[model samples]
Target: MPKLLMIAGLVLLLVGMAWQFIGRLPGDFVFKKGNVTFYFPIVTSIIVSVVLSVIFYFIGRFR
Candidate 1:
């Protein structure tokens, strides 16, 4: 449990450092019209999903 928490903390730290770069990746959508605005991170979601999937795959394999 302690090891899991430590690993989670490290992942959060790295994500914070890279947050800005991740937000602006291509395929992400942002729109503005007067006072209304909308944002969706389609590409970002896919990238994150792929990365975590790969990580978990290896973790599962080792276990």
Candidate 2:
């Protein structure tokens, strides 16, 4: 549990540090209207999901 928490924290820290670069990944979308904006990170979400899935798979396999 503690190890998992530590790893999760580290992953979050890394992501936070890399957010500036990751925030504009290709396939992500941004829209602008006269006075409004909409943003969606579909590609980012898919990448994160795959990464977390792989990490969890390994963790579960090892344990």
Best by lDDT: 2
Backbone clashes for every candidate come to 0, 0
Write down the TM-score for model 1: 0.78
lDDT of 2 at 8: 89
RMSD (Å) of each candidate, 1 decimal: 1.6, 1.4
Clash total of candidate 2: 0
lDDT of 2 by residue, 1-63 (tens): 999899889888877776767777889899999999999989988988888788889978998
* lDDT (Cα) of model 2: 0.85
Residue 11 CA error for candidate 1 (Å)? 1.3
lDDT per residue for candidate 1 within 1-63, as digits (tens), equals 887688678767876777766668888899999999898888887877787777668767886
Q: Candidate 1 — which pairs collide? A: none
Candidates' TM-scores? 0.78, 0.81
Report the lDDT of model 1 for residue 38. Answer: 95
User: Candidate 2's error at 4, in angstroms?
Assistant: 1.8
